[model samples]
Target: MRILIVTNYYEPEEGAAAVIITRLARYLARQGHQVTVLTSAPNYPHGRIHDRYRGRFSLSETRNGVRIISTWLWATPSPRISRKFLSQITFMLTAALRGLTLPRPDVMLVEAAPIFTNLAGVFLSFVKRVPYVLDVHDLWPDHMLTVGAMTERHPAYRAARWLVDHTYRRAAQIIALTPYLEQVIRGYIPGMDKVRTVYSGVDLERFRPGLDDAAFRAKHALGNARIVAYIGTLGTAYDCLTMLETAFHLRDRRDILFVIMGTGTQQQVVRDRLAQGDLPNVRWIEWVKYTEIPQAWAATSIAFWALFNHPLHRGAVGTKMYEALASGVPIAVALEGVVADILRESGAGVSVPFGSVDALSAAIRRLLDDPAYYARCSQNARAYAEQHFDAEKAAQTYEAALLKAA
Candidate 1:
């Protein structure tokens, strides 16, 4: 199959979307499919071009057998509204135009991001008359509304919704990561049979335990403390401020340490709070290489996963949750929707009510009080990740979906 993947974010821009996309693309290519990615230059979180992509123009390259194509576009990577909106539009236009000139693909898989990218993809599919599958990572304009990142009444919100609708109506099939989102999109788009659930996956082998027998602890200064680590984007979407709150709550627990291992819009603010509050049990670290996560996981006694309080959260199944489970670590989550469902059903970890520090405290204490219970959750976590959220399986599902869409 000739597959063309369209996503705004890609390599050098570290996140769940990038990780999953790269994995699927490489796996598909290895399966003997001709896979091509159409993406903007990689600049994410920090909103500037990554070192590899810096001073680079639209270019075609190959990585591990898959064909890589990046187009010139604005990617401000920051949280500034105006510049980000403009970047979205520019990348959409550039990718759409570039995509149009290529040979007609057997299937076009367009990621739903920046919202505008899907709009452009919808347009391109109609113009090219090729079937396009819509991969909904997160509900956009609606997410913006819930996070107070933007107002629902704002023109951008309305415009983004319209684009979302356009893509939905045009898509041959829709893939949603969570059941709540599947229902939401099916409700709004008037679809039923075309939608399927394909979870974002984790590399179970790479994110597994026992990698930190000894070398890892000394390297990261894990010392002797029982570490609770949070590793992922610290964006508004994640609402990680309460992580500090959790740190403060555990201030009296001298043997426990809270380690934050990532950067985002929320990083500095959380850091400032930690500094002013003088929480000696807490430690801060910049974003670690994705490869180093296993060591980080080895250092952690528990893994923390959080999302901002928003209606949009009901549609999210955080990739961090999946990865933590795959790493065989006990999870402490403050999230809603599918994540909560996974925890409850799989017994992978404990979840406090979203945004409640007191609840988070109680949950943390519950796990710490019983080591056997924690180990049970750890076993369940790894078991559930392997059984349900395997990317190897999902990648095959994705291939079949694209073929069907085509």
Candidate 2:
């Protein structure tokens, strides 16, 4: 099978989509399928093109058996909707034009996010007569609305809805990251048989438990303190402010240290809070390369997955959740949805109400003080990952869906 994946994010870009998609593309290529990825030049979380690919219009390279074609896009670090829309639109046009010159695949998988990137796939499907699958990462304008990017009454919201709906109807298959998302899609679209749920699971070898963390801890001056970490993008969808506040609430606890690792648009919130006062027990690490993520997890005693309390988020599960479990680290999730249910079912961690400083602080304290409970959750975390979150298993499921669509 010849597979083409169109996405705004890819390898060398720091984010869940980039890491997961790269893993999937490489896995398909290894499985005897010809895989090619059509993406914008490396620019993500930071939103500036990488130095290596700086002035190029497009560059084609092959890595680990997968062909990668990266095109130019207007990248920005701004959190404003209009700025991001412009970036997505530019990438959509460039990717579509670039994709036309390549050999058409048996089937193409398009990532539907940053909102307009999937338009490239839609354009190619029409021009090249290739069936395309829409990988619905988020529910578009609705997700934008959930994150306060825009209002339902806005003209842009209406326009996005129309475009998104058109793509949904035209797609040969729709891949939802969660079963809840699949149900949500089925509610609106008539012929629901096309929708399927395929998680972007974690690579156990890269994320598994018990790595030597002495160097990591020593380098960071973590110093034997129980680390309660919030690792990953500090985006608007997350309640990072609450996590910081929780750290402040427990600032007096010298044995437990709070670490916020990763950077995003909402990073200013952290800066503002830090500027207001001193938080001796809190350590903030701006960012780290993807390869160092597991070591950060290894140094963690408890992981905090904080999502905003919104109805839309119930259908969402960040890839970090799987990574945390794979690392055999117990999570303190400030969410009550599919992710929270999975945590409860696996006995891997505790879920608290979002934005509650007391509840979050208490959860961390319990996990830290009760060694037996902590040990149990730690064991359960690895067990759950082994049973369900293998990256290879997810790629196989994704491959089957792509083959069926073709």
Candidate 3:
């Protein structure tokens, strides 16, 4: 089937949304489907447009057998609410207009994030007379509210809720990233039979155990130290403060280095705190290319997955955990809900209560001190990824969802 995927994020962005969507597009293309991606130019996390697409309003390219069409957005690195809202609005308009001119496909898979992108998909679905599957990554205004970005009484909050519900009503089908997320969406839109859970799985081929980490370690100036890494967007939903505090508690261990990578709204906050403190064992990397992330994982001895203690974050099983598991690196997570459940069920790592620095620190120390336990967790990590987080299986499930919608 010919498929058109509409997402604000795409290849070269390095964010979880971009990586997941890009991988799915390539997988479909490899399976002999005519896959086309409609997205904004590569500007994410950092929010600065890539050099190649800097001055262009729109551009198109083909990568790995999939066609990628990108349009310009009002990109910025600012944390202000107005700037972000404007960015989304511009992308929503540009993507919809650009998508209208493209050849109609059998199905459109729309990633519903920033919420506005769904407007583009809805417009294209109505105008092109094609079915579109709404891939719901997060519940929008609820997430916004949870992160204290806005209140329920805020006009923007109400507007976002309306837009999300409208998209949910319009789509031929909806894809939730986790089963728990699907349940919550169903609760919001009762009797929503069309929604299905398709996890944001990891590419085992790209991330696996036994990669040479010496080069990675040498390049990072991290000689022979076991790294504990928090590698993803340092977004508002993440408890980065707790991660740092935990690191501070373990600063005496010179052999275990804490590495924080990626960029987001919370990056500056982390930087400011680091500047005010004396955490010699922690290393903060502003950015890392997506291609090098597997090697980053290779150099990591432990993966730190953290989220704020918020109800909205309960269903989120962020892509980093799966990637870590795939790389055979055990996790020390400050998480709840589905992610915490996965850690326990797989015996891949230990989960501490959100924001509990002492517990998190202790968990790390135990994993380091007990070689046999660490080895078991590492083995379980890879086994779990192989059994459940296979990228091929995820792509097939996504394909089935789109086909059903079409």
Candidate 4:
């Protein structure tokens, strides 16, 4: 099969979407399918185009046997809503135009976030008379509303809902990242037999135990300090402030350190709060390359995951959780819904109520204090990751769906 993947982000972007997309594209290509990706130049989280990709309207390259077509986008460092919306719109228009110039594929796999990319997929599918599979990483409009980015009365909200429903109806198949999201999609497009749940699996080869933790610790000069790390986009949906509060609560315990590594709109917010309060127990690092993530994980005793307390986030699962599990590092997540369920079922870590600093702090302290429990959770974490979140298995699932859709 000749497969074309359309997404707003791709390789070198250092996000879940980029990782998943790149993995699937390579997997499909290796499976003897001709896979192509249409995406914007690498500019995400930080929002500045990579130096190598800058000043290009469009470019194409082949990586790991897959063809990549990157187009220019309106880049901005600020994570403001207006700037993000403009970036998405620009990518949508340019990607669509680029799609028109490409050879028609057997199937088109569209990443649905920034939502407008699906519009381009729908158009291309119709024009080329090929089936398109909609891979929904998150539910738009609803997510926007949940994040307070849009209200019901907002014209954009109504328009987004309409666009989402239209795209769902037209899609040959819908891929939901979680079971709860599959249910939500079913509700939106009732009796839709095409929706399937394909989780964002972790790269087991890239994230595993036995890395040089001592070297990582020595490199950071984090002598004897137990590091609790949060590595991902510091976006609006995440409650970094709550993490800071937890840090403040545990400041008296000199052994515990909170390390936040990522860049987003909330990065400055975290910086400002830390500066004003002079929180010595916390450390902030800018985004690291994807290749360096395993070292970061090695430096962590506990993986900290926090999401804002919102219904929209209930169905979502962070890709970092699986990465932590794969690394044999226990997780301390502050969120509810499927992620919480996973922790409980897998016994890989502890889950605290979202935004509860007391609960989060206590959970962290408990794990650190109880060596036996920490060891058990760490062992369970790797086991659970291998059994449930293996990247090879996920790639096969995606391949089957794309083939069936085509």
CA RMSD of all predictions: 1.8, 1.3, 1.3, 1.3
TM of each candidate vs. truth? 0.95, 0.97, 0.97, 0.97
Worst 10 residues of 4 by lDDT: 213-222
Evaluate model 1: give its lDDT: 0.81
Candidate 3 C-alpha lDDT tens digits along 1-406: 9999999988877788888998899989988999999999988776799999998889999989999999999899898877898999999999988998999999999988877888888889899999898898887868778767789899978887887888888888888989887998888789889988887789999999998887778877988889999998888889888999899899999789999988788887799879976999999888888888899999999999578888878888888988999999999988788888999999999998888889999999999999999999999999999999998898898888888888
Task: List per-prediction Cα lDDT, in the order shown.
Answer: 0.81, 0.87, 0.88, 0.87
Worst 10 residues of 2 by lDDT: 184-193
Look at candidate 1 and give me any clashing residue pairs.
47-76, 47-77
> On residues 121-174, what C-alpha lDDT tens digit does candidate 2 reach at each position?
888888888888899878887887887778989998899888888888889889
Q: For residues 257-294, what per-residue lDDT tens digits would candidate 1 score against the true structure?
A: 88888887777687688778678877788777776777
Clashing pairs in 3: none
Cα lDDT for residue 260, candidate 1: 86
Quote model 3's TM-score: 0.97
In terms of lDDT, the best-performing candidate is 3
lDDT of 4 by residue, 33-98 (tens): 999999999987667899999999999999899999999998888667887888888988999899
